[model samples]
Target: MSRIPTAELSRYLLAGQLTRNGCLYSQIPRIPPARQLRRPSTGQTRTLNTQSDPTTTPTTPQNAPTPAITPLRKQLKDQAKAAKASGKKKKKKNVDNQTVPGWDLTVGIEIHAQLNTARKLFSPAASSVNDKPNSHVALFDVAMPGSQPLFQPETLIPAVRAALALGCNIQPVSRFDRKHYFHWDQPSGYQITQYYHPFARDGCISLQARDGIAAEDGEGVEIGIQQVQMEQDTAKTMAQPGGVHWLDFNRVGLPLVEIITRPQIHHPATAVALVRKVQMLLRSVDACVLGMEAGGLRADINVSVRRTGAEGLGTRTEIKNLSSFKAVEDAIIAERDRQIAVLEAGGVVAGETRGWSLGSTETRRLRGKEGEVDYRYMPDPDLAPVVIGEDLVARLASSLGMLPDAEVDQLIDEYGLSAKDAISLTTIDNGSRIEYFYRVLDALEQQLGIKADIESTDDAKQRRALIAANWCLHELGKLVETAPGVETAALSGDAETLVPSAALATILAHLHSRRITTKVAKELFWRAFRREISADTVTTAIDDDGLWFKELSQDEYAALADEVVQGEEKVLGEFARFKQGKAKAYPQGKLMFLVGKMMRQGGDQRMDPAEAERVLRARIEEVHLSGLGE
Candidate 1:
């Protein structure tokens, strides 16, 4: 056999491939080089002419048939024309009626809150956030060969409690399904989750007007809970140097309850409030560690927008792994606006998963969202169905304890607290703050000789209670968070030990009765917190410093005021010049100067500045009037 020459073989192949209309390479006329391509302007489609003709120029003839447009292209063109015409119509309507059109926003959320338990969902390994990376993994967690799942009550009980607390209808028999996905963080190719039959469903969390900025109506709004499912968590992925990633399997197989909400949230603030309420609910039951800052809780928000009266939803986007309340609101707003802008600008919004950076104003696309079919869900052959007995449910319900809402109502009705303050107290630290608040209230009541009657309309008692609440929550809470040399963790369970409730009550008692000014009370409170004074000796400390106020008779107050006025001549002259319209300084400044002198001479700045100013003003007025008459 003889091999063909390299150039002849290439020529033959090119001739066979490029020949058209049975023309040989040498006889065929070559088409002219195509013109430089021009980019189409915005909202215009660019079409390239691909027909072959040597005699014709790059531009097609005016009588040539229009290019055949596909159904998709024609649909897109029609949509663009409709968007522009509708935009013009809406603009004209707005101009005529002086009213701008509005877009209705709808938001649904999927929350993954880590279940609080001793072990992983299907393994005996411990579930912890602070454990060494990859140190807590078991054979099953890493998907080792022949390692079977072993579900325990520790995982199910907490999820059940959480679902019950949310008023969910618990299914007696819920089975596990495998959701298939390929990711570096997942050891197994599929994750075990409750899909076809979730553990709980058909619950709702009520949002009050005071709960968020969006709930303006007094009756507020109710956000429905679609379902709650049990699932296994994926491993933690940490970005390494040099564009690498490291996966820690410790988090794999950890227990999680995915709470799905209905698309009833219309505002970002309402979404935030719902998340907060969920956190409070789970933490109250001790079922989950819903700590957003600690990665224990994450939310995926689905946001969409349409014309106010449009029937169906617009194209929606999913914002994934929002770990903060602010991020939830910001991501929803950003995605909602992006979809609205796309629609108004004659473009369609694609359904995709997006991500939000810490300080970013807009969301960036991560990947196209996977549909139900993409996950390829199937029942897990290895794990058996989870069956809950009515006895177990009954026992759990009996011990359900008080939830955050109940605590909020109790605080409001019993303690005379405002709704906002009541919510704050009830939600913080899983109602631990409210317990501390009650202790402080008890101490204050005992010290002030006030009866502990819930129905009593005693204004003085309620006023004292408010005083205690303000100091404990505002002042002491700040100290607990930002005190130097004290770890925040140390202040959690033993917060009262830092400054005993007795000491706090004493400070409040003195401040309430005007025995000491607010400044002195704060100083005393801080001193007790720092252990400068013992709780048992708080009264002694105040007395020794001469900071305690003694009720003064009328004559006694006048005498003390006259002595201070006669001694502070420079301050008096300044005040007199101001009274005669000669001094440029404000009158309050001269009065404060005189009050300071009185407090200093009186041996303690703890005296009420207002009382000192009033007394000194009277004495100074008497002297000035006598001198003017002379």
Candidate 2:
């Protein structure tokens, strides 16, 4: 018996075999390397290719091919290396300086939005939108004894739907945790939320960069989403002149969806756009009303400034209770500048939470890092884990309407609307106005057998669609904006009630088909909307036989226009001279004055000014030709 050498044993192990080292063997067996190995053939011994020949292929008895690494495995290894390199590059690119550094901006947002539901999350009390302060309160709202928190299925659906629309993944199981903090408004001394296992995670929103700021091409920067959790809203606190804070418990125990974003936003404008996008998305899914002024939605912005290539994030400061997009932008800029100034003047930019003073356009310090209070987060003992099923997700997916960004894109592509017009049409002012406008459009389109053109078209269709969009954005917007003493709900409801679907469709259809001028459609719109007249009635009334034209005969109107030209003889002469290649300065001032007088004499009906101008030029030409003949 002979023992195998350690080197031979190592080689055997590399060839996928187990062999004992320094052990005597009664019978010696030989195995080849995998690359030169072959299946055994009956009554044949195969020889391995150990020669240094590059071209001569290895020949084995069974002709079995050697196993090689798969392409996918190779590709995976390459991708891992690339990712590692990218991460290293990012780490090495950090630039840090004591004086003002490089001013790298990072932002994160936390939104507290009230859910639009019929009942409170933990109580059976009504959650009506119009309920008076403290009127919809349950015993639990006041921390009543033995009051157990009960989950609201109805409220959770909207939040889940909203998160799904934002591209978030819903977790199978979510647990409610109690966040404890003492405040006069928080009677229970804690807020129940899903801190550990949130309902949804990793949602994203897209926003455009403002002028002078550079954004990435095609796809914008991806801001990592932390979580969107369901929580109970705190009661309202009203401060009186005598330093007394009165508590209203009506809103207590209401369901709220708190959406938190990662600190990836770099610019102030991007932060503002992200907030706006989130607000619109929440409203689109009917999760929360997008009310910034009345506090239906509130945002706390965390912003920090560092050197452009810094190693780590700078000291972050939270701007609390920003109710509007403008205020959020102002606060970020103000805070960034303040921090930069501090660093430039040899002062440390301390990590703190501050409140944005809208009146002063500044952020005042509230609490420093040393003074920061902990919420004492713990799992809620009373409530069990909320298990969401496929049925609920499917139902929500079906009902979750188009996101605001998608709607804007559709309007631009389908209706040939301008960016500004599309934005205006999709924006919800306190949520009610946008809903009402859409309801009106929807009903009108259905009633008039017209479909919404959400696709792009050629020149003719583009022009018509632009006209329709302009009318909707301008005339309709004015009606909604100026409706006196009207609550947003009333205004929205009234718009739906008063603006007949059939008439609106008729107007849009006529504009789409280019059958009516924009001016004529506007006049008809006022008549139909304010006077409750039908589209046909307004069209007929303004047509040849209608009262609008019947009030002034064509012959008399022509005579009055002729008289206007005669009164503006100097301007007419100049216009005629310019047309004849004399290139005289036309008397625009006098011609407009004469036209104004003629309009007054003709009962002040809205007329197309360009058409009137054409008529005046034609009449002036006729008079000049007659004079030449004479």
Candidate 3:
């Protein structure tokens, strides 16, 4: 077989035609490329044009369209050639984004947050990701003949909560539509979605802008969430050893809320932050635990650019199935540069769907994006309109306590955490841990019998909250981060299962009373966490582990003071001259440095720096060096 021309292979792959190992993987119903195989998000799609091979140089038979490489592989070649010719190259950024002299890039994201539920959206089948292949499939899930979708009432609850958390206006009436798509996993031939009317819309989320001309400083940027639709997720498709694709229907009909944001994001950091904010919000409400690796949450990003300060949105291309926050940022940056190069080279940024591979920096065109109409979206006759009552919406809204914004404010105002640290503590990824931390604070205050009125004083509360926040965010978080499967419910267990909240409080309280050093407090907290060691064992470790802070008795103090005065007699004369303001070599407060020689175990809670200063000053006074105050 002759080598396929790069451009010809690219065009064919862009058109969704591919062959591998003599098996032709045709575009199965040629569904809209931007939407999920099962559920759809806020996006535009294009009509597929079924024309003959457009490449004039192709010689391969129609039966075998051997694509030895991916579509983006060809695009990368084109990008490289353009860079070589124009003398402009892709910018490499490890810390910050490089400036593009004439272009401004904008991005938006669509998140499919898989609902954490036991059953599929429309069927009673188990929606377990770990279940055996096809073991959890229901008749409705597989589109068994004569099986119609019976809407699950429980599905709308989480969607409403997610929308409320996002500050969206819930629609009283939303309808489902049939979306035509082709994939073996989707045996139904069509997915039921809210194409014409979504469940919620018109919400906004605020994110910290990168401090520069790209974003205004001091003020955070707010991106609009266009709409969130409640839809079903598709099944998993795995490629076998010999070009065979296997479909697992176990994930079929899983609940998902497709969140679409407006294309106002300008910086890659902002884009990643926005994705993280959404993840935080979802976890706060238990609406979804969209871990990127769990396949629970995924996003498709749309990016486009234009001449700086010059116009309406440009032709956009999408990067799909971004699984992590870093992936979200990196893919956007790569796509932004690729589109800039294409436009600069006198080419067009095609309206197409692309896939991002973790192994490559470039994006591969998966299929040409289609408009909603191309999917032939029409009302699903089998399902009725989803009606939400005022009471139900109100209930969900009321239940969204301490959302990202409110939680951040409370942490800053009440807990006295810095704005940056507050943001980290309030996010959903660590949300459960933070909540558990708060409970420990309350339990600690109660155990010590600290009155609410007394402990609620701003200074008192903030001091305690800071201590708790520090331990939780630093020590506990480090442990949790390294702990496998920390994102799961097992990690969300009650504080008692780990270290009891009161036990944590005891550590902090001991720290405050100087009974233990901060270093020892952290160690005790860690040993007591997970309830592996008894509370009494934690207390005893302060002594047995030699963590007790040592204090100098009066005799010990006098001995050190006498030794310093006599041994450094020459230095003492220099100090006397320095104090007289006549002869000074280095001036940075002579007493603190003088006492430095006498101090040991800086972390020792029992050692008082002020006492050391007082002792040293008094001992020197016996030698009549009284001008040190100068």
Which candidate model has the greater lDDT, 1 or 3? 1
lDDT for each residue of candidate 2 in 418-537, tens digit (9 for 90 to 100): 677677666644444445545545544554454566532466545555655565557776655666543454445334554554676666665454455565666677667676578566
CA error at residue 413 for candidate 1, angstroms: 2.8
Look at candidate 1 and give me any clashing residue pairs.
none
Candidate with top TM-score is 3
Please give, for residues 426-478, the per-residue lDDT of candidate 3 as tens digits: 65344666677778788667755788776367897788788777776676667
Please give each candidate's TM-score: 0.72, 0.67, 0.75
> TM-score of model 2 relative to the true fold?
0.67
- For candidate 3, give the lDDT: 0.73
Candidate 1 global TM-score: 0.72
lDDT of each: 0.77, 0.67, 0.73
Q: Give the least accurate 10-residue stretch of model 3, judged by summed lDDT.
A: 30-39
Regions of candidate 3 where Cα sits further than 4 Å from its true position: 1-91, 209-218, 428-430, 477-498, 526-533, 536-550, 553-597, 601-630
